[model samples]
Target: EPEVTQTPSHQVTQMGQEVILRCVPISNHLYFYWYRQILGQKVEFLVSFYNNEISEKSEIFDDQFSVERPDGSNFTLKIRSTKLEDSAMYFCASSGGLVVFQETQYFGPGTRLLVL
Candidate 1:
């Protein structure tokens, strides 16, 4: 089965630096999302994009964050200004439709971001 894949399994950045994480979502999937887990915290949604625009976004997706489908097969999340609190495991997921019913999201292992 085709699965989502993230690059640079781990990343370390200085506080206030910019960071961009990359992912390749499952082929044939129509929706994409970004979620983060701060150590022991629960997974939180950051944003969701479909049809070339943002569909839903959480408060956590503040001014410092942005996302793009830079190419046909690549999706990326960029943090313009990283913070120490930004250190976490960022997971990329894709779903075919809204999850209110049977839509299931497939997740990549994750890209661990560490800010110092």
Candidate 2:
């Protein structure tokens, strides 16, 4: 089975700076998701995309965040401005089932983001 992969395994950014995290999901997957986990906290859902449109998003996915499929295979998340609170491990995932919520999700290793 194919798996999701992410780039720039670790990142350090200044507060108020922009950052873009990239991912390549399983080629056949139809649903892609972004999640984050802050230190000592549970994983938090950020957004989901399907058919090139946003299917769902959490409250934390405010105006500063954006998702895109720039080409056929790459999916990306951009933070317009980072904050101290935004530091975390960001995960990229993909689900291939017809009903996404019920399918098994394949997750990437994750990108660790730090704000200073």
Which candidate has the highest TM-score of all? 2
Angstrom error of the Cα, residue 61, model 2: value is 0.3
Residues 15-106 of candidate 1: C-alpha lDDT, one tens digit per residue? 99999999999988889999999999999999998989998999999999999998888889999999999999999999875552478999
**What are the TM-scores, per candidate, against the unseen true structure?**
0.95, 0.97
> Tens-digit lDDT track for model 2 on 36-98?
999999999999999999999999999999999999999999999999999999999998979
What's the distance in Å from true for residue 36, model 2?
0.2
Deviation (Å) of 46 in candidate 2: 0.4
Best candidate, lDDT: 2
Over 4 Å off in model 2, which ranges?
A: none
Off by over 4 Å in 1: 97-101
